[model samples]
Target chain A: MDMVRNFHMAQGLGETSYAQNSPLQKEVIESVMDITLRSAMEACAAETVSIADLGCSSGRNTLSVVENVIRAVCERRREATQQLPEFMVFLNDLPSNDFNTLFSLVPEFVQKLKAEHDDGGGILVSVAGAPGNFYGRLFPSSSLHFITSFTSLHWLSQVPAGLLNNEESVNKGNIYMSPASPPLVATLYFERFQKDFNMFLRSRSQELVVGGKMVFSFIGRRSHDSHEKINECLLLEALEKSLSILVSQKLVTEEKLDSFNLPFYAPSTQELEDQVYREGSFTIDSMKQAHDWTIHEYAPKMLSNFSRAIIESFICHHFGEEIIEPLFETYTQLLCEKLVAREDIGWSKIIVVLCKSAAS
Target chain B: MDMVRNFHMAQGLGETSYAQNSPLQKEVIESVMDITLRSAMEACAAETVSIADLGCSSGRNTLSVVENVIRAVCERRREATQQLPEFMVFLNDLPSNDFNTLFSLVPEFVQKLKAEHDDGGGILVSVAGAPGNFYGRLFPSSSLHFITSFTSLHWLSQVPAGLLNNEESVNKGNIYMSPASPPLVATLYFERFQKDFNMFLRSRSQELVVGGKMVFSFIGRRSHDSHEKINECLLLEALEKSLSILVSQKLVTEEKLDSFNLPFYAPSTQELEDQVYREGSFTIDSMKQAHDWTIHEYAPKMLSNFSRAIIESFICHHFGEEIIEPLFETYTQLLCEKLVAREDIGWSKIIVVLCKSAAS
Candidate 1:
């Protein structure tokens, strides 16, 4: 997949936009807020604090997270009896992300920061948009003090390379690793994650100063087994079922359904830890897993909308825009049935806090 | 005028877009490229060179200027046998500017840079979008090494206060300074320029490191007389004439025309130098004036398009979008008659290079 061109959260503030349907991601952010605040306070000790929120898709959530970071830094500085540092917050996402909406919200964001901080016009905050893939270098070396990415890193750089063997689909009838897929499919996905995450770590290590901290929260599997039926995997399976129904109804071609695969993976906690240690530039500070029980309270329609917000671009790229409404309708029906059966519906998110190693 | 919300160049890739009608601006950039390159080479002496292009309205000209700076910095470092510095280029404009178009072009820009530089994986360049009014702070303190703003300082932070006295429009029948404007109108415009430009210098002084360089090119007058019939004033006179005709035809109200004034000023060389000295942070390095003779070579239709590209937003805000076609059509006719009469038709731009004072 051409991730840079084809991958982005649904843009704008429409009903199906990531901006509106991001409550699930917000819950994850809320769950990890304490860790994020602690890491920011510990990492920022300079006169100018540079923070970047990678994959900061357009929404109220993007700046809300940044505002919290700024507040935490100010509180820490005040307790230390130090002057407040100027802030340079770089909001990063794919070039295709809707930064117009993000930047439009900045003036209000700064105003709220000032009103709440009561810094006597001393808080200097400059918010800039850094549009690029985060698996590469996005900032200058040692320029950033704190970095945050929430529910974003599961997106691999590209669909695992070599999903086909000699032009024949190897992971047929499944868009991601599933029980029906061959073992090699899981291997390919895991390998791709390793490669992309390694590049992500190495690039950020160079960009962050020593002792700078990174806090990340993303969907992950509780089980060490690759084929575990995590909530993320279950959602994709439901989506696949919807696509199969479309194929059966002749609205989509069978070949198209067979050829598509998601550029995503929900890593096991052990897998994430192992990869971080292998990279060797960052020392693990803390890692915790939280299963969001809040999903049980959400209606199936809301879940479908949330799913569409995150993957609508990928779906539109591969299947065309015509399939969106009907496909999501079918997916919503599937979720409703699953809810009736009392099946699991919430995500297990792993939040990890890491500090840049001094020796690196 | 709400400069942040209402002022922006004509957006997108249409015939009337600033992107298409910016050849005149391109000529100015070309005229000052030597000064820009020299200032860039002299300023970027660190391992991580940070550069910002202020008021970088969306267009090819924006990145084209940045590319030249990068090339010059690399060449200088190569000559000195120093390691190439990683570049962090921030492209800044008002929040309303068309950053979507600007960012969409970044990948191709980076690809061309790498292809030409043959850096062997060494030349790291990160481009970010800074959306804010540059008259205020847009970066962290002492973080920038070089700043370039081309043809952008002409825009005041807002329209001069008190164009109305006791609810009476003082600058009637004119959108900007002109021979017909009252002397109080001239004072109001100059005072606004002094305040906005002083704020611009103070904010940038705090942002730029000591000894950092700034290269600016903007519309300026040659003669000290504010009412001199410079080409810029000539163009506005033609525009005012068109608007008067609109008022006569009932396409626009006389009250609306009287109330609307552009948030722009064309400072003379003396005015600009005096402001810089009074700001007391940046030392004047070099100042030169260049008359763009190319405006005479442009067709009247092209000139109309260029004018429309620049002020269409302001016109749309105050005079309504319905008047745009007729107003510019009338503007084109006036330009055609002026060309036939061999009248002055191009701008006189001032190119100033200033270095942040080490003592400051």
Candidate 2:
């Protein structure tokens, strides 16, 4: 409950807001846009096509995917059959998302739809927000034709249980599962990921009609080794260095750092494939893995703000707002030096397109 | 766009908040609880049952329906099938609702669920808030097993077009779709209701699986006469008289009154049945209509605050907060005297349960 109250992409159209700092997410979403279009065209057979974008945090990017889907489907149908289905677009996030900002953007989005279609119901478009956790059932049985998520499936519903108070915290000296962490700690993280990922697929499977398609992209490890293969390793290492500086100065408590575990995971391609096969609801049609983080394109300031937007709520609740400016400053400088030293910052994003089976 | 920001139910759990003033809605929901349970049992076939409460304004009432659904389903399944399906409940409302307050109460709600089931894995209840307009699709196609909406569908997406103009609003003296209004004003309100309600049913039809059920209860009319049959007739009349007093006192503007038309409509039983049949998605199983408002059971103070909670956003936006206390004061006294005159306040409520067909 407190997380919902405190966790949100910053509101408003200001520079620091999620609306401004979301190009990274947009990049990941755009990477899968073609697969999303092709898969939907293959699976979509309804008169009124329904599509849901899960974990749809507030931003212009929220509508970017919706527009892509709508435009692609409409143009393809026009070329082939001279018919268009009315569109139902559902944008979902946690309840505390900046919906006011999102809704303020809707009128213009609707106007664009009108410009594409005709005024006399060439196609009717209806959009709404669904605020909930995606780890569980957020829709009805066999209800959706397509579901798309970007850079959000990595967020576990909660921090993995048993990581805390494990004799002194299994993930001690760091906030997330890292290479420095012990074998037992790595196992715990993988177990939690398996549990959560299975739950996500099972819930979405029930909500999706047979042959419905889901396209997802998230930060992931290139190999099963948690510390060695993670895409955001350099970034996490920089965050750890900043925290160590604070702790060494006695400005921040070591205990606080020990207890705080990032409820995040980067599954390997092998791990993802194994989960898909075991879950037995969806079959992977294609998968793409790319180490695509660019130091020049996404400078340190941009990347710092991006990380801050996602984790600020929990950090603020723990370390107080006073630590935010200085902490991010240190993080920014550390990440910059590291990025300059090596072009490979070691962040690989994985994108996959999967289809719900006809029988499951 | 302005409507989403200015159309929120009153916030918080204070005396004047919607949370405190929502018992009237609760009264309506309680009247249909048994029907929701039985119809859902008959229609539900999946191993995991899904249910949604649409227009679930914040407070104790949001969970009231969910709890009822969970308890009844669990008990019935235990009795007949010797097995209970895992449960998924989606509580839906507009974005501006007090979801923080609602989520704060979830821990206790989950605790109660735990206390009710003891078989270790008897029932796993997952509850989530879907913040969106129910007049559009909030879920996937054929996903839901049951849907319940109470006292919310009457709100048109926009104030019926043509009720206002650059010059002035057509229904100058009234704040809602009253019979005394001009013929064109009534037609516009009916037209808007027809469009919005048809969109609502069509969207939900695609989201619900075959044999899924929907139960709805909202303020309506016992007769087609707009000046009569409504439960809020006396209260609206009193509100009109109070606004007239303000206009005469030069404390309010005739233009403001002219521009204001409540986004509310209480359709007659005939109108509802017509919409249901015209939409052609579902068959009405049973419907109950009653002019059941009791002056003694509900004091004037209680009733007036209820109206204030719902309409405060528009009132504050147009007339400012300064008028709230005095206006409701004038409204309470007038309604009290009128209710005393005949013991009949002339408000009717209609409740209905409908079933999706085997084929769309």
Candidate 3:
């Protein structure tokens, strides 16, 4: 399936929707708020600052990051005794994203921002939705001054090619890179990430100004090996187990499960740095690994709902919608057992700040 | 009701949707294609042309105009043997508009444009949705080069405020400024139009660069009097008749019908010229009135469907959804009788081409 045409988070504001289940993403945003604020302030030196939140799904989390950036820029300008600059924010995601819900939330967001600017000169914020794949071009040349993407870049433009040899699934019994998968499976996934990430960098290089900064936070692994046992990988293993159970019960076909692999990859810090350097347009300002240990505090059902929100569209596109309820139920039960045993529920997040090189 | 929050064409692609029943709008667009093409070519003299379609509701009609603009720009450049410039198009509408449907139509629209450009250098087009009320600021200062709002400016920012006197509806029998409306009703509506039009022009002036061009096509009347007998006024009379029937049937309350008025005004050529001169930002290039006689050929049911598509949202907001079916049934029957009587159905459309003054 074409990712651009079909991929999306669970739409709307229901209990199973991404809008209602993105507290984990909100936590990631808060954890990296300082870096986002600093980058936004530095980028706001211009008279009109253009900031784009790539892969900004439908939720308050999307605008909360933008709100933080705008507030920081306003405070910094006031401190320096400079005029508050106009802000043109672009909220970007795949075309299949829930843009209606995102836009329905804009009036109140703009109202609150304007209200907060009562003491200073009035704030000027214009938010537009730019819907497209971030792996390609989305803006004009030298148009954006700051960019942020939270927990979004792990999604490759498409499922990795070459996962099949002679029309047979090479990575059977697994939905993502795992220790049980063959080495070639990891190679194919890594190669796809390298290609997609490089294209992303190249596109942003043309769109961003010379001194523009970008802050990105996405799921990551601690080891350089692609087949490491990260928390995300473990979660996928539990999901695979649930699907396998369904397959054994004749609820889903074995061939369907074998043919399914998520279009995702959690890169290591070294891997991210290497790709950025190889792209040769951006200079890494800072890179840090953060481990959020709060996952153990959440009920297993909540975690299951969160995961479902993120992956339900993908699963439905492949396995059909009938499997969602049973699939999530089994996965939630497995998660309960794992959480009760306290089996390393920590999630490792990588935050990177990069600036467009002046000489590029 | 909040116009910015509740105002939109009917949502989705169902039979009653604006997307499915916009042939009259399509005719208006085709009628003004020459003016649109001229303004687009003039605006494309720059390297990167920024074009905005204000009040671009969800439908193919929205992108058809932009497609014409891009084609004309490309042809002009290829004739001059200049490098193909990138086009940045912004689709502006209310936040409540069905942007998902609009954005869904984009990939195919863009792919067709690119495929047609295969003989020339590859086309570079980026389309984004700018959701907001056009009566206020939407873009940064001097950011756009061309603007188009077809059949949309007739909508005022809100209903005229003085329709009531001491808690009593002044225009009790009519939903718009008909010949039977009081002189004060006409005055209030015209004053609202003047204020909203001035605000719209002012906002566009700030967003449009010097020498930029804008083409606007909207419903108009031949007579200078706001209470003149126009086809649109006649159509609203039919709608008012249908609503009165519902009120008598107790399906809708009399108070509800009395307090409801359309936030719309059709200006004469003289009124439009006066407003343009009074605003003092844009110079009138040309103004002409075009009458579409083809509307008479359509079935009365088709025309009633068209009207319903445009006003269903407004109706559903004020009246309950249960009244829609019966109301439109009465409207279609009324239209059939009017059509059989050979009533005048010619729609007067005013097309104005304006250029941003260099001095401004």
* DockQ scores for all predicted structures: 0.78, 0.15, 0.76
Return the clash pairs for model 1, or none: none
Cα lDDT tens digits for candidate 2, A1-360: 154445677766786787888877887777778888898787667877878898888888879888888888887887886578877677777767776567666656766876878835556666766666677766657768999998887777777788876547878887778777877777888898899899999989988999899988998888766657454667677787788888887878999888777777888899999999999999899988887755457788888888777777777887888888889898888878877887666568898899999879
Question: Best TM-score goes to which candidate?
Answer: 3
Badly placed stretches (over 4 Å) of model 1 are A118-121
Candidates in order, TM-scores: namely 0.98, 0.80, 0.98
Please compute and give the TM-score of the first chain of candidate 1 against the native first chain.
0.97
lDDT of 1 by residue, B1-360 (tens): 688976899988888899999998998898899999999998999889999999999999999999999999988888888888889999999998988788888888877887777766757789999999999989989999999999899989998888977758999988888778989998999999999999999999999999899999999988888876656666787898999999999999999999988888999999988989899999999999877778788899998999899999999998888999999999999989987887666678999999999887
For each candidate, the alpha-carbon lDDT, in order, equals 0.89, 0.78, 0.90
Root-mean-square deviation per candidate: 1.5, 4.9, 1.4
Candidate scoring better on lDDT of 2 and 3: 3
User: A1-360, model 1: which lDDT tens digit per residue?
Assistant: 588766888888899899999998888888788889988999999999999999999998879899999999999999988999999999999888888878888887887887877757668899999989998988888999999999899899998878977668899999988778888999999999999999999999999999999999998888989975555566787898999999999999988998899988889889999989999999999998888777678899999999999999999998999999999999999989887786666678899999999988
Q: Candidate 2 chain B: minimum summed lDDT over ten consecutive residues — where?
A: B225-234
Residues B1-360 of candidate 2: C-alpha lDDT, one tens digit per residue: 256546778987899999999887887777778887788778766777878888887788868888878787777777886577777677777766666567656656766886788776535666666656777767666768999898887788778878877657788889887757877877888888899989989988977888999988887877776555344566676788788878887778888777877787778888889998999989999888876655457888888898889988888888898988888887788768876776656567888888998756
